[model samples]
Target: MLQDLEAKALAGDAEAQALVHLLRLLRRKAYQEARAYAEGFPGELRERLLAGLSLLEEAPDRLEDPLFAAEREVLLGVRAVGEGRREEAEARFQRALALDPYHHRALTNLGNLYLERGEVEAALDLYQRALKLAPDDPLVHENLAALYRKKGDLDRMVAHLKRATRLKMRPPVSLDPLTGKPKRSFRIPLWVWVSLLALLAYLFLKKP
Candidate 1:
């Protein structure tokens, strides 16, 4: 069945190609999906799928494809940041940004690294850049709010917190109330709950 689908996909059938690409993504075989779609898809769909694949941090091998090399470089930068190699990570991120200025992951990671290193201004700049590129990224709003809080800019922090809260709570038009269903409610990460509790505690303490 799968082989038949692949054959059909390779025969310029867009729907089959899209299905194959989706299956590959679900299997976590993103690089292969990108390669297949790049090889089989016509033009715009191919470009979009390849771009989506490049965003996956796991697809380093896909860097060999010229279209994805810049994304791969950004992923390497993020890896360096994770390993505590700040300078190398920053350099790599800069290179990636030079190649694609609106790379959201690279911008966010660079902002976070700068924040960690106490370069608050630089971090804010990077976060702003990221926001321009990916306005709906909750993490970016969260981080920016954190920065403003640390800087004692209460008004800006509160504004950003409101934006983050709205962003976090926007729901799909329909949701599944049952478990083991095709549609389900999004799970809030544990850290968000923890932060909420902390905020409540601070408010309670201040009420006295």
Candidate 2:
């Protein structure tokens, strides 16, 4: 796990380096330190890493794929969520699904919104769809664990929790730096993925 991040960080992948360093600080409940470290970054990155409320950078028009469009909406929805704009966030997530139904992040995020609104069945459906697309995404498993616990299904909840934990313990060679989450080996357009990595450097950087 460390090797992948280390290699990328050494190779000047600023996003990976930021994640590796900030995650360590945040996990230790060092919010000030995390914030300070984030401050050290230049320009928009520093702001984004501090949860600045800007729209996610637009993807290049040449991409011309619905998946990149969907990803943009998903990242924007994530930012809206951080800004506490639940209704807007819901709209954005729904729009993403309309563009590309197979978008894992959009599905998972929409499921999370539904779960928060007490729409258990709706959330379950979306989560299941997301799991189909990215079966090894630890966030999906963790979310399923939460959903099962809410339904009073202790067995299923415990199973998902354990699965998520095990996945996290393994090396995150294919980690999604945007969210600091483990991901399965699935192909995504390189430009789209890089754009996401650039815009969402703080998607998971909540105050500890």
lDDT of each: 0.69, 0.71
Residue 14 miss distance in model 1 (angstroms): 15
Off by over 4 Å in 2: 1-67, 174-208
lDDT of 2 by residue, 1-208 (tens): 4456668989999777775666444323344555656676678767665552122233322333331355556777887999999899999889877765556778889899999999999999999998887787788999999999999999999999999999979863543434443467778989998989877776656536
- Ten-residue stretch with the least lDDT total in model 1: 172-181
**Model 1: per-residue Cα lDDT at residue 194:** 100
Q: Quick one: how many clashes does candidate 1 have?
A: 0
Assess the local accuracy of residue 93 in candidate 1 as a C-alpha lDDT between 0 and 100.
Answer: 79
- Candidate 1 lDDT, 1-208, residue by residue in tens: 4556678989987667665545433222235534554545557765765565755555664556544545667777877878888899889878767765656667877888888879999999998988886787677788899999889999999888899889879862331212112364589999999999999999999995
Provide TM-scores for the models: 0.56, 0.53
Off by over 4 Å in 1: 1-40, 43-62, 172-208
* Candidate 2 displacement at residue 153 in angstroms: 0.5
